[model samples]
Target: MGEVLQKRFPDMVALFTGLGFLTVLAELVLMDHREGIRILAPLAAGLGAGAILLGLGFPRGRVWATGLLLLVGGMGLLGLVEHMQEALEASSPSVVRLVDEEGWEYPAYPGPLREGEKEGSPPPLAPLALSGLGLLGALALHARKP
Candidate 1:
């Protein structure tokens, strides 16, 4: 079993990475990229695809795969930071409510939804998934180097 796994590790990595990228792509598509920053999501998918292709035994595959993985990994880290910041911003109180002697309606009260009332912050840990995948793929590719 050990020998078999050793021989097929690269193939396994490529297969799992491809599947992960496809899942991420589906999520990004469903979420709809209306903002400029959201472009990174699709870009990561494209880069991951390229890296997977290179990892599959192309000429100089290891070099290209490693480079792309590093690039995407860095992007993922940056995205993680950006997402955290956005979450912080979303959680921070944007408006100060001044309640006088009269009772002021609480924002969290169970009532009709306000027009365009936005949802909670984006999942802060989402970007870390990409970063992890990038680093994992990079490590696997490097380990396979002759």
Candidate 2:
């Protein structure tokens, strides 16, 4: 089943990988020198679709697994965009200035999905991080038979 799934859903894997890479690179390309905003909504959609493909267990919990995986992966993409932006900003060339720009509307999307950062460490991206987990999980269950 896993092998069948892998063959049938190659695009799903590709989509997941692409979303992961693009979201990470968004800050490098679009917004500020902090630097950019790449189109991420489509990527989010892709991940959701990939998740559904992944959680499609053979005869056991196939439907429910597919649905939940889809939901988790889809939501992860949105969260990644929001969380990645915050991370990139903190890791930006002007990290200090950007961080100090008081009352700023984040100038992008929401800031960090989790609370706190290192004294100087770039912000942690738990949300963005989860997307990878989803990807790996999907990949791992590429062709689950049962």
Candidate 3:
């Protein structure tokens, strides 16, 4: 039973990491439709998928795992930093004014969505956190092997 579990560990990790990456990609795509945003989602998804494929195809190779972990981890870390910064900025009190095409002026709510105020959504930190955790797990697993 222990041998069986040990043998399946890498496959399970690869599957989960792949799914996590894909989920993050989907979240990024759904959150925004801008071209700039689209670019990152595809890139992240591709890299993540590639990592999974590499893991499955070359289970004995440490290099692929290391490279994939580094890429995904770095991206996730960057996302975490970016989101934290955004969250901090959102928490601050600020007033914003906007003028419409017809020259109508309106006051915009500052920061993330507040209670009973439903116009804008808050920045997504969940994905960043998940990705970061996944990356850390992968790194730890890698370190523990041999």
Q: Positional deviation of 82 in candidate 2, in angstroms? A: 1.7
Q: Mark the regions of model 3 whose C-alpha exceeds 4 Å error after superposition.
A: 33-38, 59-62, 95-124, 133-146
Candidate-wise lDDT, in order = 0.77, 0.49, 0.61
> Which is superior by lDDT, 1 or 3?
1
Give the per-residue lDDT of model 1 (tens digit) for 46-98: 78767876876674778788889888888888888888998998888555455
Off by over 4 Å in 2: 1-59, 88-126
Model 2, residue 103: distance off in Å is 27
Q: What's the best-to-worst order under lDDT? A: 1, 3, 2
Cα lDDT for residue 31, candidate 2: 33
lDDT of 3 by residue, 1-146 (tens): 99976877766666777777677667666856336433554575557666666656665755666576667667665666765775676576566989999999998865777685535334656536445635744664475344
Tell me, by TM-score, which candidate is best: 1
Q: After superposition, how far is residue 121 of candidate 1 from its true place, in Å?
A: 0.3
